[model samples]
Target: MPDIISIGEILIDFVSMESGVTLAQSPGFLKAAGGAPANVAVAVSKLGVKSGFIGTAGNDPFGRFLKDTLNSYGVDTCHMDLTDEARTTLAFVSLTADGDRDFVFYRHPGADMMLRKEKISEDYIKSAHIFHFGSISLIDEPARTATLYAIDIAKKHGLIISYDPNLRLNLWPDEETARKTILSTLNLPDILKVSEVELEFLTGIRDIDSGLKALKDKTSASLILVTRGIEGVDYVYRGERGHVETFKDVKAIDATGAGDAFVAGVLYGIHERINEFKDGHMTSKALQDILRIANACGTITVTKKGAIPALPTIDEVKRFLSERLER
Candidate 1:
């Protein structure tokens, strides 16, 4: 059985080769395995944790490649289903003039979105120590039901539930629908991770403090982490809050999987100290240490390109932290 299980979409990302160009203007595109929950599972597995992925993939070469990629990273995929009803999800990404990403998605009932509730295995979910999910999969039917059902099983097994909105505005039919659907199940997780922008989207407050306060008022999640680009991470554990500063003198090239890598680090820490968190006992210093590891993992990810490729292994994270300490 795995220590951690992440459930969501795992698909191919077609990235344009040319910089500062749209997809039409790009010379060519490169294929990469891209998905938020899968990235977190891979990152956790890479850090020497027993992580597993529970989701659906298309019955195609791309799906096989995705499975192989996770296997290469030492992530378990025994429960990852492959469906023939729909093709895999695809996202075409290109850089704009200002270095911002412009994305176009092709997921009209993608195989990942076809994850049915009947296909979900309660046994697999019960076997995991922690459960992680994203908001993207909750946009539609079968996947939405499947995700919630799995969460219920995880809860029954006393597993820690971690949620990250991982918002993509374009994927939703409307902002109101997205906001309503997400908040409807917001009270499920023990941990919630979101970016500053996602915080605003969730609570309609731009300020992290007020946003977090509003979220706490709405949800029962005990721990909430807000990642502030270069500013660092602000976290509220139980009732106390703290901040961890971002590493200085670091040059971030591609921030593709930075957030996932950070989440992986946090999950790893929780897995190691599962009893403490389950017992509702944690010190401010202990929480800060977890955030520091997560910050380093994100820092390492931003230094390289791609999601899974950029994620650092356990040795790499330790080396990165040790080098920083020496500096």
Candidate 2:
């Protein structure tokens, strides 16, 4: 049985090395595996965890490549679906000279959004220790309902629920609907991960503390993790709260999947019973360990250039930890 089950979109990201000066401007593109949930699965697997991806993809070349990539990373794809209605979702990312990115989607209701309620098998969700999801699948029909249904089942089975609002403004019809729906589901998660910008947008509060308070008051999630680029991660647990600084000084090439890596690190540490020092209580020591490991993972991710491909192996993470410890 898989220890982690991630349910949501699985697609291809075609990132541009150059910026678009105009609508007709074309830049050199690099194809890579992407999708928030898929990245989580790869991250978990690379960290020596038993992880699985449950979603749909097109019956096309890109879809096959996605499937093959997941298997190569040691993620179980037994619950993956191949659909004929739509092609795989493609995201065209354009990066500026400052390393900022803007995205243009090529989604016309792709296969990932076509995941059906019927395709969600009960056995799959019940077997996992944690169930993870994001908001992209909540933007569309069949998939929207399907994702919610699976969450319900996972909750019923008493699994730890993790959510990431991983917001994409281009995918949603309107900001209001996205804000309402994403905020509404916050209460259902045991752990929540959101970027600083996401916290602001979701709560309509510019201050991190105010936004975090609003989220906690609404969701009552046991743990709330807020990620800040370069600065590192800020976490709020039931009994502990603080910021964990970056593990090392490393030049970041692409930060596409750094948050996902942090999530994977948190889950990995928790699953290995590394938090036992806290004895089920959110003690300061436990929080420190979690933060340190998570920072190391995130730092490793940024050193590489892609999402899934950037996930570090166990040895790599250990080396990072050792290097940091020696400093």
Candidate 3:
């Protein structure tokens, strides 16, 4: 059984080969496997943790590529479903001069949305110490119900639930629906990871103090993590707040999967110290250690391109930290 299970979209990202090119003007593309939950599953596996992915993909070539990618990275894909009903989802990514991206998705009821509740494996959900998910899966029908069902099983088994909004407004009918859907599930996870913008947008508050206060009140989650690009990451855990500064001079080529890598680092930390976490002995020092590694993971990711392709191995992360410390 894997230590962690991540469920959500597993799709192909067609990245523009030329920098600062729009989708219309871009000359070529490079295909890579991507999806928040799937990226996290592969990230954890790269760090030597047993991980499993549960999602739906088209029974097409792209879907097969994604499945093969996950297996190559040591993620168990036994729970993944292949459907002939729909083609795989695809995202065409064009980048700005600064490596920021624009996305155009081609998923008119993609295979991922076809994940029925009946297809979910209850035993797979229970076997993990942690279950991580993203909000995108909740936007659709059968996948939505199946996601909630998996959460219920994880909760019943006392597994730590992790939720990342990984908000993509375009996936929803409107901003109102996206906000309502994500906010409704805020309290479900024991650990929550959000972007600084997401925190403010969800709470309708600009200041971190006011915004987090509003957010904490809504959730049974004990830990709330907010990531600020380059400005670093901050958190509120059990009423205590802390922040960690990011590494300087990143020179990022692409930042697509940095957040997922960070999430994986955090979960890996929790897996390593499961006893301390279970016993309620998560000291500030322990958290700092985890966040440091998480930050490092994110930093290493952007230096490369794509999501799963850029994730660092545990040894790579250690080497990165050591080099930084020596500097």
Local lDDT at 231 for model 1? 94
What lDDT, from 0 to 1, does candidate 2 have? 0.84
Error of 2 at 139 (Å): 0.7
Per-candidate Cα lDDT values, in order, are: 0.87, 0.84, 0.91
Off by over 4 Å in 1: 96-100
Q: Where does the lowest 10-residue lDDT sum fall in candidate 3?
A: 272-281
lDDT for 25 (candidate 1): 85
TM-score of every model? 0.97, 0.94, 0.98
Clashes of each: 0, 0, 0
- In terms of TM-score, which candidate is stronger, 1 or 3? 3
Candidate 1 lDDT by residue in tens digits, 1-327: 888999999988786766677788889987888889999999999999999998888999988899899988889998888889888888888855433466799998788898889888888888889999999899988899899999999999999999988889899999999999889988999999989988899899998888888888777788999999789999888878788997866776667778999999999888888898888897788788888899999988877657788899989989988898997
- Give the per-residue lDDT of model 2 (tens digit) for 1-327: 789999999999877755434223645677899998999999999989999999999999999999999999999999899899899999877655544567788888798999999998899889888889999999999999999999999999988889998999989999999999898898788888999999889888988777788777878578888988877787778835677887547776667788888888888877776345224565667777877888888888877666898888878999999977898
Pairs of residues clashing in candidate 1: none
- Residue lDDT tens for model 3, 105-157: 99888988888899888888888899999999999998999999999999999
